[model samples]
Target chain A: MNALSLRNLRKIYNNGFEALKGIDLDVEAGDFFALLGPNGAGKSTAIGIISSLVNESSGSVSIFGHDLRRERAKAKSCIGLVPQEVNFNQFDTVKSILLNQAGYYGLSRKLALQRTEYCLKQMDLWDKRDTVSRRLSGGMKRRVMIARALVHAPKLLILDEPTAGVDIEIRRSMWQMMQEVNQQGTTIILTTHYLEEAESLCRNIAIINHGKIVENSDMASLLARLHVEHFVLDLARPIAAAPVLEGCQIERVTDKTLSVAVPKEHSLNKLFSQLTAQNIEVTSLKNKTNRLEQLFMDLIDSNPIGSKATGNK
Target chain B: MNYSIAFRTIVTKEIFRFIRIWPQTLLPPAITTALYFLIFGKLIGDRIGTISGASYMDYIVPGIILMSVISHSYANVVSSFYSTKFQRNIEELLVAPIPNWVILGGYVSGGIIRGLLVGIVVTLISLLFTDITVNNIAIALSIAVLTATVFSLAGFINAILAESFDDISIIPNFVLTPLSYLGGVFYSVNMLPSIWQNISMGNPILYMINAFRYGLIGVTDVDIQMTFIITGGFIITLTLFSLYLLHKGIGIKN
Candidate 1:
């Protein structure tokens, strides 16, 4: 059985906005699943429901096959949520925050302390253990939140936009730490606007838009489906007009360079051969980083599947 | 399974907060109740003689003590819960495996302790100005506790509904202030016209104060037994409603 499952999960706010509409998802054990979405795509709402922080209007959510409503405590025990907002008590020190969080899991003093210390050390928060959470820099506070979530040793850890607004150095360190944790048999679920992070870290991907899931599949398969590629050409001499390069489309006009989009299967080799034949000496050539984003944007714009469908099976 | 451990955790956190922020949470009520004792009991006791068939100082003691208890209890939960919301810290408690009732009860218990502590401090300060005779100690103590709990639950609900910092200050400033004063903290409801007196019977705070007053000096502006009934009823209702909201993840979830 999957570690977590949401079947036909629906969330309709009292204000008449449907933040989530029948989203069906599954996280198998030991899978690093990245949930991607634009702003207001209901990522937070989905996490809130699974974490038992928000109630669903209609749906079935099971953690390790335990129905959420029937076995709430058991289901909740297995899931840890690092919210998009750093929601720890600001007045509390890093240690106190983790300890209190463990206490809520009904951990005794000794066990709570041991777990607190371990989690804090793992997140590099041991040195600032005594500092009030609010006084820490934004990155440090984010780390504190991570430690707090992991203190109970939950089987499923959901990180909702954990690296948003964090510095690049902190984000990189956090990514490394997350990788180590994921390797230790915890089924990890991460949500982020950073597609690059999702592309690199997650083997499975699910993208939601406007409160609906648009895509869910293996990361490599989703990127492969795009089958779109781009290559830039450098002319040997300044050409007054745009080059008539076959199979390559001019994407932009810039001084001293031309940005071209090439379909991966249509033969970039032939385009390169043509450029060399025309004495259009290619000074530089590079593939656009994962053309999946363009495909995603195009999908979101034309069909706008996000509005009509809830999610795919 | 062990309720006491959970209870202890809440009580400790609350007392710590009270001691840490004494100037804001503890001192104000102690000072306010002390001034009431000094002016109403000391200066005025000399003019009025044995109002409750005891020393005039004794007549106002229960009101002053219960006043502190109610205000502190209300303030404690209001500020604590609202601050948690403001700082987004409630997620710590919300994401836990603990049951919702436990969370609500723990917070309510904390407010009860702080409210009672302020009540005791005010009672001690009042002793410097007036003498309070404990006619029925158990009843007086129970009433004070019950009153604090009811206000604490009310404050919790207010805090949950409050969306902004200004929202926190508004209810205390307007609704709570009016209700507490008009609840007969100073003068007896009997002094008002018959219609107003009948309406005063509807004010829950009056039942709380007069019930304690009945226990302290053995005199009440309203029926003591009825006051106890009303106070108990309000406490039960508020507790049930607050627990229901917590379980439902009402405003907190949003």
Candidate 2:
């Protein structure tokens, strides 16, 4: 069974704002999925509807085959949501927050305690469990929220911008913890603006814009659609000017680095041979932008406010 | 989901909150009640003497206790729930799988617990001032519980309607405090002119305080049956209204 399914979900605020016009998404069991959208593009609204924090105007939502409207408790029990904001009680201790979250899922005291300890240790918050939540730093607070969401051990975990405010070190640790959780068979859905984070952690992706799904496909299939990739190369020697190479679009970035855009239709062998023929050696080369980011920019620019939906299926 | 566990957790967390900040939540009320008894009952009752068949101090003990219960009950739910809304922690309970009644009962129970606990403390302190007698202990306790429940439900509604911290305090400061003071707490309506007595009958809190006073000293300014009916009716109405708000997600869900 799919971990989560949304069919024709729509939300219209009281102010007559159509935050989510219509969104249909399906997350398979154990899939690490990314839902990407620009600001005010209905990503948070969609997450809110799925978590039952926002009332959807129409359509259906289900978790593990339990319809949200009919079997709300059952459906909610299957999902965990880490919202973009820090919404925990600031006065509450870190330990109490996790325990109370587990209790909300109806876990027994013994089980809640066990899960709380496990989640705290995993989030590296075990030592600071006694501290009030507000006293923690921004990154620690984010980790506390992650631990609270995981304490219930739901079948589906949805994290919205989980690493947004966290530093690199904490973000990496959080990513590792999430990886471990996903490896244990939990279906995880992450919504983030960090395109590289999504490219690194997610297997499949769905990009939403103007409240519509513009692209949904496996990571490989999405990345495979890229026609050209811009790479920055560190040359072994200084290049005084742009390389006059055939079939390779090259521009001088710095004395020792060259920026090159290589089309997928042409192999790197031709570019390397051409560069070598010009008496230039490349020490290191890397893509300037990930394929997902490139496609995301292209999709948003091409699709207007009211346009036909585009998805690879 | 386990309804019992969820309910208990919410109640436990709320109780812990008040207890964690005992100086703010529990102490101020106790000290305030003691001052009321000292000034109103001791200093003022001496000059007023007896109005009902009982001593002046004895006559106001039940009223004093009910007053504390009402204020504490109302204050507990209003402040706690409003803070949850302010801090956005109410979403935790909202997104949980627990039923609406469980959430309502959990929060109301917190208020009831705090109110009753404070009422008991005030009762104990009152003993140092007056040698009180109970005509019907069961009825007295019942009225106290019912009063707390009614006010707690009212506080919940107020919290839901509250948009800011000041909005939560507005009800208590502008309405509740005035009504409680005028609700025949310190002086019976019988002391007023017949015209004013009729107007005092319209105050719902007067029925609650009179019913509680009747339970304590076997005396009442209003009909005991009507008092019970009004208090019971208010409780039922407030409860249904609260449940409807929760179901509709009014003032909570966007």
Candidate 3:
């Protein structure tokens, strides 16, 4: 069963801005999905509609078989949304915030308390539960939001840029926690600007640009469409100039670092061997740019303004 | 969904919100109302003697208590709802499965609670300056609750229409405060010239204060029956208007 389904969803704001233009999407139950988009690409608007914070101009959204328009309570109860901003009451304590959110979902007081404790422990915020929300660090506040969203144990979770300003260490920890959540059979839909995070964690991906879905496919399949891959190679020793290689583009980024662009058909082994033959040694290598990011840029570049691309499963 | 739990939660959160900042929500009103009793009821009333066969100090007690109810009720909802919107935490309720009526009921209940609480405090302080006797307990309680409900709903509408903190203050400062003072909290409408007395009848707060005064001291400048009609009318109209705003997501959702 699909955890979420959006059919012909549309949103036009009061100022005559069309944020969403008849977009369709679906995420299967328990799937880790990424809704990647750039700023002003309508990701937040779409999330806002799905969460019922923004009224839809037209179209339908269903969650776990509950139609959003006709069965609003059931649909909303089935999904949990972690908004991008810090939106909880600053004056509220962490525990109170989560418990109140649980109560809003109709959980009994005893049950809400239990869930609040569980979520706080899961987010590693148990010790800070009594502190006011505004007193917490930014990353801790983000975790509190995630914890608040989970207090009701909704089957589907939508995270909108949950780690936008979070430090790398906390972001990785949140990623691990999210993976645990997904492993526990809760479907997760994440919208983020960090392509690497999406690539690393999501099995399926959708890239929206200018209110339209330009690419919707499995992660590996989308990355496979990239014709060229760029890598930054750390040299074992300083090199005089760029290496002479056929069927590849290489540039000297520094005396000891080289940036290389290898076509999809060209083997990295071939380039390494050629470099070794030229008496140059490579210490370590990493992708210069995220592969999904490259494809995303290509998709956005190819699909200009006023162009619409149909989303595929 | 357990709407009972949701409603209780919203009410509890709102109550806690005001209680958490007692200095701001509960204290100032007590001190301000005490000063009114000291100056208007004691200092000035001693010179005016009595009106409607009741001591001048006792004459203003009901009006002062009801005035607290009106202003505090309106202030609670306006400030609380506007703060929720400003902080964007209102999405917490907006995204929930709770119905719009439940949301409306919860916030209004919070305002009513605060309003009545302050009303009780002011009544106790009134006792400090003047001997009080209830002419009709049921009528007094009924009008207090109804008056609170009316103002709470009005505040909800104001919060919905407010674009900023300043916008929230505009209604209470310009309209609500003036109406409360002119509603005869410090003087009787009967003391005014005939034409001005008729104009005072146009103010809704006049009916509420007069009704409450009749209940507490058996003295009223207006008919008690008209008080119920006007107060009930405001309640129904404001409740419907507030619910409509919530349903439309005005100033809340884009």
What Cα-based lDDT does every candidate model obtain?
0.80, 0.90, 0.93
- Each model's TM-score for chain A is 0.90, 0.98, 0.98
The best-first sequence of candidates by TM-score reads 2, 3, 1
Stretches off by above 4 angstroms in model 1 are A232-286, A305-313, B1-11, B165-199
Across residues B140-221, which tens digit of lDDT does each residue of candidate 1 receive? 9889888888888888888888888788788778877788789876777877999999998888788878888888877788
Q: Is candidate 1 or candidate 2 better by DockQ?
A: 2
Q: Which docking band does candidate 3 fall into?
A: high
lDDT of 1: 0.80
Decide which is better by lDDT, 2 or 3. 3
Q: Which pairs of residues have clashing backbones in candidate 2?
A: none
Please give, for residues A53-117, the per-residue lDDT of candidate 2 as tens digits: 89999999999999999999999998888988999999889999999999988999999999999
- Alpha-carbon shift of residue A231 in model 1 (angstroms): 3.8
Q: What share of the true interface contacts does each candidate keep?
A: 0.62, 0.91, 0.95
Candidate 3 lDDT tens digits, B1-254? 88999999999999998898899988887898889889988888889999989988999899889999999999999999999999999999999999999999999999999999999988888888988889999999999999999999999999999999999999899999999999988789999999999999899999999999999999999899999999899989998998899999999998
Top DockQ prediction, candidate number: 3
